[model samples]
Target: MSPKPSRGTTRTTQYQGNPRRILVGITGGSGVIYGVRLLEVLQQKEKDGIETHLIISPAAAITIKAETDYSSRYVEKLATKVYRFGNIAAPLASGSFRFDSMIIVPTSMHTLGAIASGVSDNLIVRAAEVALKEKHRLILVPRETPLTLIHLQNMVRAAEAGAIILPAMPAFYEKPKSIDDIVDHLVGKILDLLEIENALFKRWEGLSYS
Candidate 1:
């Protein structure tokens, strides 16, 4: 468990150079690997002064264990801090969590729907809601194969509410040479939206609306 923030005080990232803090959430979905990969990259960045806080849904925990054999505890270790699903009282559940942004990787449609509807049944939803209310960066990465109308509607709502609707869709425009390359490309897009410089993938060149 991460140390709770002191009441009525600003909680800051524990790094020199005042690195930015980001909140990453992993929900139950097919592309759970994206969340893990993002964590791996962010942890590496932590050594260079970047900090991260994370929240993992029970479904995400199970999916990681089943899909990748990554011990949930070890995966949780990647973050500067981790919060449980039901811990609505966690610092991030409030607008004062002092995070620069939040991203929900492999966001389950169910979770997305609840967030779109302003439902805060769990810390994941609550944290996202807080991010919305606080006008902080909020990104959602859904990996669904075929989105339904309801899913589209929910995504539209979240997008209209200042959340970045970044689906976990990777493109071959850069001609990825490997599977990891594709993953890195998608992560690179997320980092770009967050205004974080990343060397995850090559940027598109020679592309124009013309």
Candidate 2:
């Protein structure tokens, strides 16, 4: 568990020449690997002075165990800070918390509906609300197949509310060789949206059909 922040106290990231602070949220979605890979890349960025704050839903813990070999404990260790899902008092639950952006990897439909309806029942939802109100970057990576009209409508609503709805759709143009390649492609796109530099996947070049 990460250390708790004092009530109403401002939490600041390491201010060593414009370091990027990111907030990541993981929910009970099928593509838990997406969240795992994202953390791995962010951990590497620590050398560059980037700081990451993570929040994992209880359902996400079960999904992570079922979907991957890694334990939730290991995943938490990858982040610079971890906040309890129900800890609405966490610094990240406020707009005053200095972070560049927030990304919800494997954003479950339930979370999506909640955020779209302006519900802030939990820390993750509260943090996302703070991001939107503060006009900070907010990315949602939903991971569900056969999205229903309700899901699509929620996505549109979130987008209209200034949230980037980036679904976990990997492109085949990159000719991925392994599962990691595909995973990196999605993560790379997420990084791009965050304006973070990464060479995790091959970029598209001009092509000709002759």
lDDT of 2 by residue, 1-210 (tens): 523322211233344576678999999989999999999999999988788899999999999999999999999999999999999999988878878788999999999999989999999999998887777788899989999999998988787777888899989997888889989999999888876799989888869888
Residue 166 of model 1 has an lDDT of 83
After the best TM-score superposition of candidate 2, give how far the Cα of residue 59 lies from its true spot, in angstroms. Answer: 0.9
Top candidate (TM-score): 2
Worst 10 residues of 1 by lDDT: 2-11
Worst lDDT run of 10 residues, candidate 2, spans: 2-11
Could you tell me which residue pairs clash in candidate 2? none
lDDT of 1 at 130: 86
TM-score of each: 0.87, 0.90
